[model samples]
Every structure is written in C-alpha cells, then in structure tokens.
Target: MNRGRQIGISVSAAVLSGLLVYGVYLLQLRQIRLTETAEVVVPRQFVPAGTALEREMLTTLRLPSGAVTAEMITEMSEAAGLEASAPLGGGEPLLRWKLDKFRLLPRRGEATFQVPRDYVKSVSSGIRAGDRAIVYLSADGLASRRLFDEPVIVAAVKTAANQEIDNPKSSNLLSMAEGDKERMYASRRDANGSIDAVNLNLTEAQWLALDNACKDGAAKLVIAYDAASFGGEGETGS
Candidate 1:
C-alpha cells in the first residue's frame, strides 16, 4: 500500500511540472508575437525632398519589428513641420535623416555667402547643412589655412542639378508620380556637372572678409567641416 502511494505521488508531481512548462511555453509565444509587431510612421503619398511634412502626408502602420530600423520615425508629431531631406514614396517608412527644419537663413547681425563648388568638394561630399566649416584662403587651391579665427555654419548645400528637384515650386510637382520623379532625380544625380556648393551663414564682419577674399581672386575657398560641431553635437560658431 505504501509503494502504491509513493507511485501516485510521483505521477502527480510529473503532471504538475508538465503543466508549468506548458504555461511557460505559452507565455513565451505571446511575448514573441507582441515583440514582432510595432506601429510605425509611413508616408501616405509621395514626399519630396525639402518639402515640410504635415499630418495628412503621414500615416501609421503595423510593421514587423525586425523590418524597422533605428532611423525610422515612429510618430507623426515628430515629423510634422519638418522638411524632407530626401524623397520618400507612398507607404515607405519615414526616416530621421530624411527631414530637416531649414533652421534659419541668417540671424540678427549676420549674413550669408555662397562657397564655390570646387571649394566645397575639397573637404568631401558628406558636407551637410548646419555643419561648421573652416574656410581656407589661398591664391591657388593648395597650401591654405583658416580664413577666420571663428568657425562658420553651413546654411545650405546646393548642387546645381538638384536645386530645382529639391525646391519644387508647385504643390502638384511635390506630389508628382514617383516614377517620374525618380527618373528626374536619376538623370540629375548622374549628369556630369558641377556638383556641390556650401552656403555659409556668417556675421557681417565674416562676410566682408570672405567677400574681399573672393573679389581679389587672391584666395580660394577651401572648406573643412568641423565634424564634431555638426548638428548640436558640439559648440556652433556664430
């Protein structure tokens, strides 16, 4: 009789262990499902570069969590009123880098000047707006030093070919068919032409100094981006 009791006790213990394991397995499955899906912000229509985002232009979707990147914006409020840095298509996830605030052209007691294309290319192609760059003055392109003691912020980077594409004047043009716009951008991006120029946001004194340098043809503009100072990463020079 004792042997039978012991056997019954073992059987009960095994069944309870099995039930606990199964419950844990079910919880694991639920956790996986929840983690695999997320709500992300997506464009409702073609969003062109430099166009400010509005609530109507965006919508949310339940996307696979694995498919979303860190750069993908999750909220419409985060994107609204910001400009698109690049073109995004319908149903595409809006990325953080594809938007900008335009910031401002010039502040009080400040001015802006356009740096020649050759000068902008000297530093590298990654030059972006809001970057602080040191302008080098040299009669020829070689052997130069800083033009000013203070650094200057880049207001804009304009490629001759991409100007019209980025700054579309008409609202309809902004919403143009994706294919047509893609073709247009492809042609512009591929064309052999003058590519990049930097618009320097400067103080009146700084502008005068740069202007004099350019007019005399005694110095050429050579830009060196202060990578550490770009986009609130470090101190911005006035």
Candidate 2:
C-alpha cells in the first residue's frame, strides 16, 4: 500500500512539473506578443537608392516603437524624415528613437533639365543623348560688342544622353514674321543653321544667374563634347 501511495505521489509531481513548465512557456509567449518594434516604409523621394541606413539617416526618420501600424509607418516619413522632421517640435531622444525604426531600399528621381528650347534643338540636331556639352552662357556685352557677347561655362552636363536633354525640336524660320525670318536667315547664313535654345541642369544659384543672363539676351549653345569626346575652343568652329 505504501509503495502504491509513493508511486501515485511521484506521478502527481511529474504532472505538476509539466504543468509548471507549460505555464512558463505560455507566459513567455504572452510577453513576446506584447513586446513592440518599429516598422516603416519610406517614400521614394525621401530615400535615395543605395543610401546607407546609417544613424545619420535614421535621425531623419522619426518612428515609435512596438507593433508599428501602417499609418504609423507613413507618419514615420513625416516624423523623422528630413523635411517633416525639420519643423517638428521635438528633441534629440525622439529624433534618435525615430531613426532606429526603419530600413531603406532602392529608388530613383527624375533628372530635370531647364535648357532653352533653341539650345535643345541645336544640340539635339548635332549631338546624341550621351554627348557632353561645354555649356556656355552669354556674358554681358561690352561697349564694342552686342550685349550678348562671349559664352561662359556654367556647368558640365553630368547625366547620360538618355537623361540629359529633354524634348528637342528644330525652330522653323517660316513660322516667323517675314522680316524676322529674313533677319534670322541673314544672321544664321554665315553659320550652319539658326542657333536653337537648349535645356541644362544647374544648381539653384546657377539657375538664377543663367535666367538673369538669358533674360538680357540670347545664350549660345556649342557642342563641346562629341562621340570621340573631342572639340572645344581650340577646334575649328562647328
């Protein structure tokens, strides 16, 4: 009888131990479920392709921790991201916490060119998309020459042909007033054709300067770089 009682107690203890272990596992799972993490989907504009997910980048992304929702993620762009975060009334801790919230992926932005149409047509006629241009803006005229005197280099074209010039077309002299066409023909008669305006990408300051200069008079477009990457100032005029 005593032996049977001892066996029963041992069985009961084993069952109790198993129950305790199961309970501990369930508690651990609950804790895990309650724990939070940050998740975000940054917009294409805010995040550039191949941008390193460094702490500096993170400082820009303000995110809250724990089971982050989609709304919360969208807000993340507005939160810690550069533009949004800039105005947000927050401290460093909030900024740092937000940075710790997300990851970055590949994205692209449009490369826009603001070249004059005439230049675009001129360069497009002679140059292919990937061609380089030694872009020259018209310098102010001196007493001896017309206000549109010499061309000055403003910027070097950085993008490939596919990305550089946009919507190139030839200017029609026939469409001009009879007198205007005659004058244009006479001026261009010494040249290959009428000089067309072209578009170019430049910094904010460069754009402002170029705009002011062009407003004063016509700007010249010369094909400085070609297939063989040849020709500029020293070469015979194209």
Candidate 3:
C-alpha cells in the first residue's frame, strides 16, 4: 500500500512537471512579446471633427494587448468612410466612439447615404434621426423629381459638431423647459440637431438612381418628412 501511494505521488509530480514544461514551451513558441501585441487601427494624421475618414487617413499598428481598450478600433475597414464624431490626433489609436456608425453601414441590401449641406436649399421644420425622409431631386435645376418611390429611413442626423443626434426626450424643449443645464443642453442639441446633413438608408438601386441623376452636376436634393410625430423641414435643390 505504501509503495502504491509513493508511485501515485511520483506519477502526479511527473504529470505536473510535464504540464509545466509544455506550458513553458508554448510560451516560448508564442513569444510573449508577439502574443502580447494587438493590431489596432490608428489615424495617420490629425483628423478634424465631422470629417469623413478615407482609407488614407488610417493605418494599423501593433500595440501591446495591455494597452488595447474595448473601445479601440481594431479593423481599418471599420474606420474608413465613417464620420469622425470627434477630433483625432495623428498616430493616436482610433477609438470606436470617435466614429459615429449610426449613419453608416445599413441593412444588407441597403446603403446609408449622407446628403451634403451644400446641395440643400432650405430646411423648414426640425428634423431628427430615425425618421423617414421624403426625398426629391432636381437634376436640371429646373424640374424636381421624386428621389425615391418610397420614404426611405433616415439613418442619422449629425450636428455641425459631428455629433449624432440621439433620441432625446423631446425636441420641443420650450414648453417643457425645467430651466436646468440639462434642459438648456437638450434644447441646444435639438436646435443644432440637423438642418444640414441627413443620412438615409436607400436600396442599392435607389442609390444608383440618385447617383445617375447627380452625375450631370445639375442635381440637388430636397427632403420632406412624412406626416408623423417626427418632422423636419429641409429642401433639396442645387
């Protein structure tokens, strides 16, 4: 019985020693420095707020995993074409929150398109994101045609500060003002919400249709809100 106990103990020690050796081998094979590094997408240059990121603006860097954060962008593809929600420094690791995705990448069959403010004529009612937009296009600067057969979904409405408008409690802040800082900021947010850039989710065909019309340098877009609790007054005419 004593001999058996000794043998069992020796076997257990040998297994543990083998496991430790194997673990060490794995660590050596993986190379701690290489295994500890994570690939993160970073800005190549200082990017201003509201600027749309292009492929040229981004680069990948191998940073220590310990330095990587949950919010840091890992894929360069993920950062391209996204609107910078805030200013980015040169060579700084790009964080996800710095880019607003609410107006980017839509459903599988649809694409999100942002209308430049320069193509707009006037905005009448207040607009917010998540509402559908009734779009019209004037290609000849004389005649206006419906841009889409249906009211497309507005993906996002960004303020001049490049901040995407969130679902606030209400846009009509005057009647409900509590005279607090939150109220003031809310009112300001609604005021600055968006009269300029409106992102819309459009079908691929619809996008091509808009593109074809605008190719002549004659097209301008106008947006009207469908009758709903959400409303905004914006016109599309070049």
Candidate 4:
C-alpha cells in the first residue's frame, strides 16, 4: 500500500482501538456501580433519637452495598413521618429496624370515627388506611348529601371481625407468594362483607355533620378521590 493509504488505515485502526477501550471502561464502571453500590434513604441532617423523619429531612444516597443491607430503608415513603429509634448522622443510611412503626391513627386534637357497615352500600372495596374519600349520604339511593365539607383520611380499614390490614400484628402469611397474598386478602374479604368499618380521623364539626347525616340518610356511599394502585378508580381516562 501507498504511504498515505497506510497512514489512513492506521488512523482508522487507532479510532477503533480507542472506541473499544472506552466501551470496556463504561461496561466496567456500570458493573462496579450495579454490584458494589446501593441506593438508600439517608438523613440529610443529624437527626436526634425520637425525631420524626420527613421527606425534606431525608435524601437518597448511593453508598457501598456492604454498608446497606436488606433490612435498610431504601424508600422515602418508608421513613417519612416515622420516629427514629436511635440518633442518625447526616448521610447515614437508615436501618429499617431503627424506626418505630406506629399505627395510622388520629393525631392529637383529632377525633376517631368508624364507618358503619350500612354506610358502604355502594362503596369502593379497596379503601385502605391513609386514603381520603368523600362520604356521601343518600336518602333514596338517588340523591346524596355531602357528609363533610372535605375528604377525610381513613385511619384504618377493618374486616367484619375487626382485623386490621395495613398495621399487621405479625401476619406472616402476607409475605408469602403472590397467590397466598391474594388468598389471605380474599379470606379477609370473602365473607361477602364489603367493609365492616373504616376508621376515620375527623374534627368535632366534621364528626357532628357525619353523625347527623347518618341519622337521617337512608343509604350511604363512599367515593375515593385519591387513587390506590390496585383499584379500578379510573372511570375517566383523565
């Protein structure tokens, strides 16, 4: 080959070698990140013991996998509003065992209200704790009156026998296979009972309105405004 042609071939070979090395570097970097590192939720600031963690106070951090075990908190939702069992340093990964698990009951200054079984005449079956819904009172099953001026947060959902689902008192059966989970849930629901009671946190005025409405209303229906992932809340595609 001519000198110019040989130089052109050498240039092409050099470019190919450079691309191969760069690709190998990228692959190694990815492998290192995937195997050696873990994403976990950590406190953005030094949090004292018994301090409630909020979304603003927590952040996602990538730390070594050995530093974050399977029992470590990795989601913001898991640590949000939970009290720390021990003091945590800034940027330290939160251990799941070091957080207190509290029931989703009413906070201070809020009263509790249980949804009567008769109130769930045409209600959504998938309502759980932390869901906000508008409770309506219907006289003839046609016209309905608003029970409260706003949606109320559900504190707990109980079966007819009063078994709590969200705040499990060590129901290990729920952690099994997906089929077992369905069966366990279905067993809670399969008595043909829609919902025995749904505990709600309400103010005095809101409680009075609901109490008075229940006395006069012939039927009731709860329509959930917020969406839970498992339910068919999408009547409209909006």
Residue-by-residue lDDT tens digits, candidate 2, 1-238: 9999999999999999999999999999887766644545443334433222323444433345544554443343444422231222322222333332111111122223456544331342333232234544433353222222222221222233423222223222221223343333332233233324334334455456545655545554333333232222112234
| Model 4: worst 10 consecutive residues (lDDT sum) | 229-238
Consecutive 10-residue window with the lowest summed lDDT within model 3: 229-238
How do the residues 1-238 of candidate 1 rate in per-residue lDDT, one tens digit apiece?
9999999999999999999999999999888976897888988988766455789878998887777789988988888877676778988888877776553345435667776554332653444455557777767665766789977766766666555223233221222223254443343334343436568778878877777777656566667656454333332222
Candidate 3 local lDDT, residue 76: 79
lDDT of 3 at 194: 49
In angstroms, give how far residue 168 of model 4 lies from its true place. 12
Query: Per-residue lDDT tens digits of candidate 3, residues 1-238?
Result: 9999999999999999999999999989768766688899888988776566889878899888878999998987878877676889988999877776434435446777876676654443444564556778865547677878888767777778877655355443332223243553344344545454677778789888876766556776777766442323232322
Candidate 4 lDDT over 1-238, as tens digits, reads: 6999999999999999999999999999888876787789999989876566789999999887766788889889978978676778998889977775432445445667776666555555655554566666666746767767776767676676777654243232232223254543444344333456778887787777666666555555554544432243322111
Instruction: Give me the runs in candidate 3 sitting further than 4 Å from their true place.
Output: 1-105, 139-141, 166-190, 229-238
Query: Which of the predicted structures, 2 or 3, would earn the higher TM-score when compared with the native?
Result: 3
User: Which candidate number maximizes TM-score?
Assistant: 4
The global C-alpha lDDT for each of the candidates, from Candidate 1 onward, is 0.64, 0.38, 0.67, 0.65
Worst 10 residues of 2 by lDDT: 101-110
Q: Write down the TM-score of every candidate.
A: 0.39, 0.33, 0.42, 0.44
Query: In model 1, what are the clashing residue pairs, if there are any?
Result: 85-98
